[model samples]
Target: MEDIRDRILRPGVNCGQLARAHRAAVLIDGESYFAAFRQAAMKARRQMFILGWDIHSKVELLRGDAAVKAETDGAPITLGPLLNHLAQNNPELEIYILIWNYSMLLSLERDPNLRFNLGWTLHPRVHFHLDDEHPIGASQHQKIVVIDGQIGFCGGLDLSHYRWDSSDHEPDDPRRTTPAGDHYGPYHDIMMIVDGEPAAALAELCTERWQRATRKSIDVHGQNQWDAWPETVQPWFKEVDVAVVRTEPSYKSRQEVREVETLYRDSIRSAQRSIFIENQFFTSTVVCEALEERLREEHGPEVVIILPKEVDGWVGNKFMEFRRVNILKRVLKADVHGRLRLRHPWVGEQPKHGVMIHAKLMVVDDIFLRIGSSNLSNRSMGMDTECDLAIEASSPEQEAGVRRLRNELLAMHLGFPTDEVDNLTKETGSVVRVVDLLSDPERPDSKPRGLGPLEAQEEQFPELVSEAEIVDPKRPLEIDRLLDIFIPDETTQHSWLRAKWLWVVLGVLALVGLAGAWHFTALSDYANREVLAETMAGMARGWTIYPLIVLAYLIGGLVMFPVTVLIGATAILLEPLPAMLTAFAGTQVSAIVLYFAGMKLGRERIQSMAGSRLNRISKHLAKHGMLSVTLIRILPVAPYTIVNIVAGASHIRFVHYVFGTLLGMTPGILAVTIFTDRLLAFLRQPDLSNVLIMIAALVFLVVLTRWLKRRFT
Candidate 1:
């Protein structure tokens, strides 16, 4: 039978294209990649294109250089300033940098004023752009650096804060501090450097992405006369072919591409001796199933995987963690011959904080080596845009290079010399056996690169980790198809009412919430309507009371108190007519106060609080006249006061704001006042007609809310 590698691997199917590299080297860890990139950038004569998921302006690319930092006028040798210096020094060189336009959720986590500073610096040769042209939930995740179109670097390392770390991966390394001087855990990632034709190929990829994002054409000239390859960085493979694979979501009418996933699946299936993978995430069901299938065969090659011990984000912790655990369990179940091993890299005496493993890398025996920004996650497979570079060993020399790189990576993580790892592997004829022999099970707490198997406690949550399978599906699914999972099985009379069950269920929940509020809150016990009305009317005559009410609303907004509760209180305290007018005036005042307060806090703070959803919603409201504001006010998609602040921060017009708030609040104020004012009467008389009327009003409110949501959203 033909080898699976020969049969499954093909251009445009499992990869984008094949290109030759006169010289290629693997830069292990961010420290090495950053240094190499810095040297190359400094030597650029024409153009330098830098692109990443994130690019921090002040991220220290060259750390531990007290003399060099002082020599540079103490201006901090960060990525932004360094690039500016390089561009300014080389007047003919054009530097274009592209970073993903991250959501507001990460606004505070990154530099708050990076965009403004980058633009205000006013360097004609330096250009910076934010790529926000991807699909809703997707990100541009390629990390590439092309210098003078002659030398290029591509892999998982991003020129950002806390990404720089030595190969030792000391958990408590003092050099692992951020630009803000806050200490962080040691990080690990890899990058590949290629010179010659392959570098120009990567440069072409960067140009296409740049044009797509900024609509600006970046001229790709012929072979560069200048050589930008760093003299210090030695080549690992000479005269080899590198395959460039990509994963692009279907957006802007472009066809979807899953070349990265195809390459990964094919590579796993083709492993003859061993399959090794190290990734930050392992939540792709398809990849897991592929591995599980291979493990089912009794004579299958041994598989070893290294992952971070804990998930980093909300979705990662709850959703991805679940999927990871579930998939590992399935793989273990299929591993009847015990050929699979999954562990995380540890560096403590007692297994304290594990080093963060961010490298997306795979090695299949000695035939294939891959390293890039494509994680073994669902997003990398088909949602997020990704790029990976791979090399298939076609000759003895190339195969030796691949094998040596894999062994070097293992030695770094295992705290063993490269030769020792090789000797152990040769002695045992198994990669897993070598790892087991080096790992100290009896003294698992020992430091440096002790391996810690995933804890036995993960078996308890079989079903929880599987929830991430929804968002991390391995293939591209259309919006309609993805949404259909939420639809009910039973047919409905009206095609437009296909989601009627959702509305019905929401209505029931709302009613239950109302009942709970009435029962568990002060509303039921404090039924002194006459006393409250008299007291409120007596105070209403004084001008001081109005300011106090407005002040109270302002303070309420600051504390994030629910506006509905305040409105309900207004209905209970005053008569219907006065309460209606008071509600209108009070809400407008509150909105005005909060809007300006939000303005004072600035858009960054407001956005951080509102998150990306509120920012997106505020943009919609700003684009419309009164309808968007009115819809938002009525539907309660977000907290009322926060929306007001978001509107203020987002620069919605005051006229539109006041009118929309008035129109949107009309129904709610009237309904609540009618219910509150008539509550005591209904209770005393037990009038069925009044009760039926209140029920009808509630139903109408629900129906209107649903209609507005469908129309606007």
Candidate 2:
């Protein structure tokens, strides 16, 4: 029989040099992890390295008694202030922070002032850098904290708001508020604490990311800095091998690394009796396919997946939730032995929301335990950046530690003591049986805590959700590939050709309708007898006529007069402020009409018109929707209405769409409206000021257009 090491730990599957771990503890959630990190950070004598996707400046590091004491001693408790305090007080200590250059749309959730980035930069010893070097849609998603190269933390919890929660997960904890005093729900995540050579190895990983991002290096650990390990936190495992793995997308020059995916698949495949998992997302097709294969085995492991009942944001709703259901269907079909159990942890009886299980954790048959930031999503598999660490137990002591950690996690979810879980497992000789016992009717409060099974159902509007796959792709995307998905290459007629034909027919009808109005209406007869310019000039002077003309422009878009024509006409006919207001209002109103029409039409019909581009846009929007929409609006990459229609049809949040449109259209609208008004004045009176106004408008338009294009492209 192959050993667990031989089955799981290969060179590429679990990348990086396997370092000997002198001691390791599995910190269950951000509350415990943050507390431990605080103690370690306080004791650090030399250096500290912190890396994350989102690191808020105002996150409270020391909670409970530690926080109370720190406050008593006149020490700052929040992350940014605390780091600054540490750096200032300990002159010899060097601190480095690397955070992902996340979307500006998330400004409300993160540090809007960017004090974490700028405030830390002002400090001499505390160096901070924003990692924006990855692929367009990829994120630097690893969360690692190394203190003085002696103690290391790697896992899902970022030092940010809405992540600090204890394992008890009280349904209505008043203490679960952000620095801004915004209350959040209960959360769950895990971080692995390591000391000795393994800690040094992770410290090296942090430095590598920092150096890649900043193009500069600092000596973090000159000699072994093992003296800084906190005495308070107990180690679960001693003298075990640690495997550091990562998922890096190929960008510019860096080669893609998918060690996390490979390790997960191999671990699932090698499970002898039972497999347990906890993650923020369960949407990786590759990972799901692997589980399916394992489930098909006659004597395969019983898999238990603990996940969040609902994804967090609109993008998450757009991409992950539906994909999860589809993936869940595939897994359920393969579970012939009735072995797979998918659940979400709940707090009280019929809780309002399930505890958000953000822990990227896995365990197999008490032989292997893996933890890190790699979620079971396509992004984590190969697209976005990730890091995962694992240990394959080789001795009795290591096995005991792995088993203990697994039970601890399961116990927390089941709302039972670890000893109860241990006894139940021993009595039944099966982890699956233990789960059955905790959830049985005979047990007191047998409602299984918050660990409830997720029921499979037919997802509503599967195509709308499926379109998100383009944005939340499993692999790197090329421009050509994205275009192909959105706009088909084949000229050959297909079923969708009928939809295209209808659009062409509609265009012809629209032109005919416009012509009929001009030829048959009273305006056409009036135009034949009077000069058009003089009539428009007289009409512009009428107080009610100008508003009526603006109304006509807004309504004209429904029948298809090019928006540019309406904009130019509005600019030429009216004075600057009225013209600007008219154009902006008309354009926005027209966009809203198309947007609503698209949303009403549904995704399948829209796909027939635009093909996979819908998916590509969805994928990009998932990660950076607000920015993408803003850029598209500013640049006029496609027709203005078409952009709105696509966004609405694809179910991009209404708020995001409106915000992008409002901000993006400002410069162009002001430039064109002002330019046309000044040009008309120059023609009538030929004043020097009017000429200067036109020149300034031209410069603004050119500069704004070029800047926006460069920013995105």
Candidate 3:
């Protein structure tokens, strides 16, 4: 073993911490990774840390031979149950889990916290926290697990649903199903396991993340000897120094970091023989240009990349493909020597679908092996929080191990033996040449179980290409960008410096920023439509919801809340018809309360509260009467409550105010309620027809928004 103090990883450069590990191994696919995790977890004595973008309670962590032991030993096989079982058995063992507070869009795919926290079977020693401390539009995407500071696992494999799969990735693998018995397609991923100094270093990193997320320090109990490494897995490298790289967006006082991105560019420039990559996405232009630069060289290394045929969702696939195609165009144009190959793994014959390659791995000339949660996407490079492990060969044995690892990965993808890949690589000087020798055919489909050329699908909707930057941003959503989206720069210029409409600018931008950020409240934890319906139905039966609903509207109005959001919430909690009527009543009541409050507070107090623009708008409302109030309601001119107060201060007649409120508020309330109901339906059971209908509705809204903007201006 090497000295732990002889660290090669430099902080703020290529890694947060670099240390030597006695043994390090790569576990291909979820079956191997999950099984190994279960084995290592079963050996935990003091503490464990689990962190990831998604951590479902129902993930099946063990199967095959591991499942057999679960039945005999009376230990649960599912991740949540297994951990709880272990915790109950060993009172000294404290398991801490920190998972991203995922968006509402992913609620159905993830289990509610009730399954992990409220269940009677759950053990007290198990601590769980939904991490929401990240910058807007960025997720805590690191997948890392540390067991008692001895053994550590870090990679793209999350302990979540639809992750478990054999290396074969057969198209119709029956084992690929959710806990509720719904089927999924072939999936692929990788996990790296390490012990010795690297394990302890990773433990330190995990605890730091925990402290940031939970505001509490994790007490580390030390042990020099670690025998918890999984017995089934074989070490790929021995006596290796590995660097732990990280990527994080700057937020508040925390500085930004992009070590993974920096290393990718550096490794690409240093490649002597080849660049072999397997990733879910390849859309970062920065990385594409780095490859493009290398490809332009007269005798540069060949570059080979493997990507999935499709992603999970229709919208995500379309957007990612749009971005990927654009990058593919740039790289192919630079490949003057034709030393580039892009491929997708297939079954015995090309089928309707193929394995989803979720591994984030790169081998540059077999001299550097990089693997972890970072996909070759813009978000993974900057916006999203990411972690990766890299080892630059400092010895001949280490260099050979890197070559062997890349060869093994290529062999599995091509459905050939590892030794065959090794031999072919030696026979041919180039990986691109090796793939050609193996895959070239007189006719298409001649080779059943080998690499298939993958190119960008034709752009049926070229308009989606423009949305690549918005959908896969490389940095946090800034307030200035969001403000520009809502209010034009010219509109904010004169007002910002004077701090005249600064409050208004911030208020308006807050609404847009919140949407773009997808930042959720605690209510988002129980955001499933079915869950909301059930919970509210029980509350409704108690005769308690009606008053609380009115109270919420009043409080929300006073705080300048977005009334449409409240309306949408009401729609989710009740039948569509009831929701519309309730929203109308709540808004009308809230309006009257604010209107009277404005009268009592007078013009001076109103100006102090609603800003200087209130008086200007009030005069317009007072003169136009019902028509002005109606127009304001239809447009996003001001907050709902702010308008009510200003209208009260105006000399507008009370009768006209009542009629305008009814006319203006009805359409918005109806639209929000109907849309909320329909959106829930689509989310519950998505189909082509539902998607088409939603598109039509979106187009209609765009036209309406333009008309409203013109009229209001």
Candidate 4:
């Protein structure tokens, strides 16, 4: 039987039509991509628009010579300065940057001393807006640069701090800077500069994004934003076709396209000689499956990936990295000739202080180039919106240009020169041969040296583990192979057993909460009638009741009681605190009860009953863990009651479930509770001023809740 990779990579299979109608070229690296982008912005004749999930104005594009010094005191280059300079330099240039509206307060308080604060920048040529029109759970994640309707850049690199560094990837280079107060890590990224019909198509995409984000019309002009316009210029590539892929929330009749995944599939199917990739993640099973088939083919192209040893965040590691490592191990099993390699660049230490790779680039046989904001993971493919620019080389010259681009990227990785790369290629005839020659086991001292401030640091921080050994495609999946996907591993089972009693305790507490709410309502009504009447009279005078009602609901929600039941109980009792306490207690109990059901039913078996929707939910929960669960619980966005039940029946531990629920629900509960209490007080007192105060308090709580949710969840 043929191996998986062989079956996947066998030649002569035309999966689909290849669109070739435009030409494109652009040098991409952390610094160069930005420099080229800045140059493109300067040359924009008509309009420039940028959209991203997160945009920081403090990011500096062009570091000053002083940056090389360790002093850290020279004028900090920032995105604002660059845009300001561009707008000032060209009066006709119209630039708009739309960043996701994280929170109203955060945006206003970002930088008070900055000249062009995002909240208050008023340059006529430059405009900034917050994007908040998407559905509650969606984000605008497209990153694009359009200039003069002639050239455009679209890819994964964002205009943010910690994304700047030369391809040299120096270890201790003071020239490298990170906003997080650490030396920059090794990163790989890709972007395409498109001209001709493709450029026009990209320009149209920018216009659409601008309109969607800002609700305004943007006109494209022929005049360039550059200081002097060239009457005519030659095309970078003979002919190229670019497809504009996008994703947004389901709005009206429009459907979001899973462009990132589609592109990945197409690239995998079209590979001829080799498939080279650089990404922050390697987790998607579907993509891995395709690669696995290719690896089984005798003449299949070699697969190479450059990634960080680990992901950056805790949740990312737990959910994404672990899964990714397991999948890669399986893929390696199909590599009979050891044609697949996964490498993480290290400047120092076995683990600590090693620079993480975060670039995303894919090159296929010098015929196709893909650079974009998508990672090889589930989120970038379909969950979070993404955009990419793909250019195909149809002719020999175009293919050569593509090869040059690939060599430039390789040179950056190996710390060599363009001409040197060309010479090496001439001698070796392929990247694989050149890499092998440079990386000869016996000649470690003869490898091309990285230049600049990091040279000394590099020596101090030599590779502890062999790169080839770590990434050898011949390695078999070991421990992971013994573990079943649905079955609980030893750690998971231990965790569940350890936390089992907690669920029982919570269930009992919920009953107490329910009983308490009922008892309080009865007692308050029976004995506090006069006080209740007085409070009601005061409320009639001027106070609002909505705030008090909201408060009751929040307290009930936190305790795991039905919101309606808690509200009714509180109103009947005329005692806010008891009603709130009862509600809170009840909700906790409900969660406990649900958890026990999950433990008994088995998470996997229960999940199967719910079908794909629940399966997706399970994946999301597994990926994001307690944080995501808590977010959904507190917000009550996606059937919180059902989730509570399903989560209990799932693999999530009781402790995580409890902690996440308690923490995530706090904000919403507090806001509603405070609102309810204020409204109740106002209704009892009948003071117009009190009513106004209640309104103000309600608004404050809402805003506060929203802020807290964004910060933590």
Candidate 5:
């Protein structure tokens, strides 16, 4: 019988191209990949290329082993220090690191791009660039490491945090912690390490990316002819050929390649026995449609998919899983023969924050294996950059090797040995049946270790988040789509006024707020107005009063205490200029406080406090950045504190939000302070001193407004 892999593994059809790997191995999870990378780098003498969606230098490669730290008199085996040591020690070496110039929406989770050396400022040989050379919304989503063009590592594991776990995936593993000491849940991923032709190919591929990202070309033509593979790493396959494939989105001069998408469909059609998959996300409609095509077959191969139970303890946002459920509903509808099984890994008697499966892998017919950074999602199809490595067994021995790997992965999930899983599958006549027999979440037994059926459950999703394409787009974002999300067709130009008109409206509203507060507080009860004004002015001049005024704004904003009331009170109490300064300082401080609170609480927890309106601000922040924060603040679309909390939970940069708040709040704060102060003075006595003070304040505000408009617009 002809090998099914041979018919489908054609160049330019199923994949973009192919490259041979002399030796290949799969490193499971962060700990394995990190240690392997550290070992390989120690032998690197020429150059190293590090490319990722994110890069952090603070990640500790080795946790408990104080060998490297002890040798260095206490410096840990962190990414930055390791790279620095290699670069500084080797004169022939040049290191290039490229990371995505990401959206601020992920600002809280990711460390700031610390410019090449992480934050430590490593040797000058290290070159780092924050690559924003893609389409506006698309990211540079490839995570690859090539050392000296001799060995390469590629897959879903980035040199970032929230990725470290053993195969056991203990629920309370003490070692599962970030550099900042915050404990995170178990994370699972795969990294494919290859040496020889594949390594050189990866080096060449990412060098092109480097040139595209940094515009500095270096020669990667010559092979180093040295083996850089780690001695301790277990080799998955040897003396076998491997195919390298990719999904590179078209933008500018670059042409789009949907090879990964095509390869998936081709491989699915070629499968005869079973198709097994493990992935971080499962929202790809095209892949699901292909699965549907196969599922409709009366005696088609049984399908098994493994996914994370939820998105909270993992990398994705909540809405992606909500969309995953929507996709699952479609795929399950096509399963007429009960041949498809969706499973999630669990640790305890019941699932409590299930292990985060970050691996992107698939095996078909126990003869072909595919592993890479590409997820089964719309974005991973052709919108984002992706890379994958595949192998087709050309011999019976190699085919059995592939079968053994699939069984081993199953055994790891099922908490059994590879032989047991292999034997059980043969006995049950199907892999899905074996999984169903042992993989039970509803089992009454005290210990529940293994896979459980993946099901769609009711999720708490905010409005507009159900717009799936908005979150996981198949193409680069469109301005029309963003506009459609931000504005409705019914209310056109009139409701949202021009800049000048908006200022006039806000100014009038501020004056009304001052008058209402004065009346509501019964300020007329004071017998002598001059004496009352003098007493208030004296209180404002005291040093201790400033902190008190700021504290009131902080407390008032969080507890839904009306901000206008606090502003009006400040205006009534202090002199015009002093009152304006006080109001601005108070509001900025309160926003900063709420923003940090939102940072610690995260998005879902913030939703519990602020609700659906946060999505409105988040959507804006994603598209508009600083301008969105400014506009929302000026218009007061949601509560003052809610916007700040959402901004903290969103992509808006901290500096941008701070300055935007200042710009947006300046007009209103100035208006309330000046007008309320003048009104009180006028009511007391219509004197030239009060009149001159009001005129001077008005001039200063006009000048400030004109300057701001010219600078920003």
Candidate 6:
């Protein structure tokens, strides 16, 4: 049989014909993606707009060998300072960034100690805004950059932190940097560059996103952020029709369209040769289901996936890892000819330190290139907003370029030359043949390698598991059907009987505890006087020190009574003026503990626990780190005790949680301490005005608690 590639490239069925309608170029990995994006940005004559789920301005567009001297300034280049210069130099350049409105509660309300509002201080020429009101919790997750309607980028690479690095991938290279602090690993991502008609289509997509986010039309003609166009950065492919696919559940209600998900399904079904993919996540049941169908066919095309061993964050591992594992199982079952393979790149023997794959891309034969920010998951398909650029090459030269790019990626993975991989493809007939030769399980070379020294170091660490498992796709549960498992069944009489028995047991315990307290207090006059005073004061003033202590105990129960409770107890017992200081200490300790817990739990388990009330709490911990956690704990709206428990369960880190907690709780602690001191003075002296102020404070606390419960729940 003729090889799949040859069949696709054969006369009349030429792969070039599919993409000839537009101009296109292949970005093999992160290095190429950034180079292409920077080149396009520099050459823009009309406009520059970036749309993403999350856009971190600190990301370097060009690094390592691609770092070039600035035309206007002689200083070494960085994206933040350089963009500022570009905007000043070209007044016509309008740079707009639309990112997902990560919940305000998580981003701002939870982190009280942060001094800078990152969204506000990006750049003078750059405009940033959180995209909310797009239907409940839906997000804007398209990673696209358009310049002058001439060049466009669409793929998984986002303008985010820790994404910057050189293709040299030297593990010990002192040049690696991260916005989130040290200890973070490097990353690998991919994107597609296109021009001509395809570029125009991407521009339109950006305009549409801007209109949706801001509810106002934007004119791209006068807003181009770059000076004269650089001819070198122009699109590589010429004259091809590229279709724009988008997903936004909020907008779907207004317009009956499901383009993004449909595109994925149709594209997978249409593949007749080879399907190559690189994604940050691989947990989409629908996509997996489609692949399973293809795998069952004896003549199905080969499937290849490059992914990180796990996602970056702790919550990501808990929530997404399991689903990905399950999805891979399904893929493996269909690999009858051993035509499917999944590989993750690691920098060192320890999986934690190496660069992880973060790119989302799919190349089908040499004809179609699909790039986008959307992960292969249900949430990205329609639940969350997403956008993609699909470019096809119609000419043989373009097809050859695409083919060469694919081989280059394979070469990098296999430690073989791009030319050698291309020759092998021509000689052997299928990608599987080349992959098998380079990826023998018994051979050390078959194991994935990192960029350089990172791989060497990782080799010294414990090896990761590589055995494949099988999953049955037919057992998937529909969303509505799955809800039945949580709902109660018909057993009204039995439930009522159980409730009565539980109430009786609770009442007996309460009576016994009350009697024991009375007996213990009777033994000491001071203890009895303090107990009576606490009861009377709580009833009369609605504020009592005993209740506060009890509240601390409740918090301890919720957060598994972590170190926060002990610290808070110590502070309360020792400190006079700073009574609330203990609460702050406790909350901070709990937050740190939770962060470490989340990181240790990993991604697969997290996804399984998503959608619950506790899951939302976990997400808040992951999204904001310690800052947000401490803020919420200090803010008096949510119970400090509950927050601590949720924090530990969510898996936030210890250092960030502790720091953020200490900083965020300062304001609240001071306020509460002053209020408590004033109340204590009123109790001792019996001042009417002081009593009134205390009453007001009590009322505020009650009202705040009600509001917080309603909002967060």
Best lDDT among the predictions, by candidate number? 3
- lDDT for predicted candidate 5 compared with the true structure: 0.74
TM-score of each: 0.70, 0.68, 0.68, 0.58, 0.66, 0.59
Give lDDT tens digits, candidate 3, residues 614-710.
Answer: 4543443466788767866776645577568767776667778878998999878877787777787789878887777767766767887787676
Top candidate on TM-score is 1
Clashes of 5: 2
Error of 6 at 186 (Å): 3.5
Task: Give the C-alpha lDDT of model 1.
Answer: 0.72
Per-residue lDDT of model 1, residues 356-382, tens digit only: 889999999987999999999988988
Candidate 6: tens digits of C-alpha lDDT, residues 581-675: 54554455445554455444434453343323234334434666765655565444333433443455554665666776677666555545555
* Residue 350 miss distance in model 1 (angstroms): 5.5
47-95 per-residue lDDT for model 4 (tens digits): 6667665666756666656235413433324566667767777777788
Scored by CA lDDT, what does every candidate get? 0.72, 0.73, 0.75, 0.56, 0.74, 0.55
What RMSD value applies to candidate 3?
Answer: 14.5
After superposition on all CA atoms, what RMSD does each candidate show versus the true structure?
A: 10.3, 16.9, 14.5, 19.9, 15.0, 18.3
Model 1 residue 566 CA deviation (Å) reads 12
Write out the backbone clash pairs for model 2. Answer: 345-450, 346-450, 471-619, 485-612, 485-613, 486-612, 486-613
User: Any runs in candidate 5 off by more than 4 Å, and if so which?
Assistant: 1-5, 65-76, 112-117, 221-223, 313-315, 350-353, 440-448, 465-467, 479-713
What would the per-residue lDDT of candidate 5 be over residues 1-713, giving only the tens digit for each residue? 23355577888877756677778888877878888888888888888999998877888887655334445533347888888888877898898888886543344456644454465786799887777656545678888999888899999999977876776778887878887898987678888899888888889988998876655678774346666789888777877777788888766446788889988988998888899999989989889989998898998889999998875422255347767877788878889999999888877654465878989999998689888989999989877888898888877877787888778888888877789889988888798987886675454642446887788776544332524454477876543233334433321334232111001111112222233334335652432335544555566656777787788789877864567667888787667787889889999999999988877774657555334334543544566667777766665334576567657876678898899899888777877777678878867988998888778777786777676544433
lDDT score for candidate 6 against the true structure: 0.55
RMSD of 6: 18.3
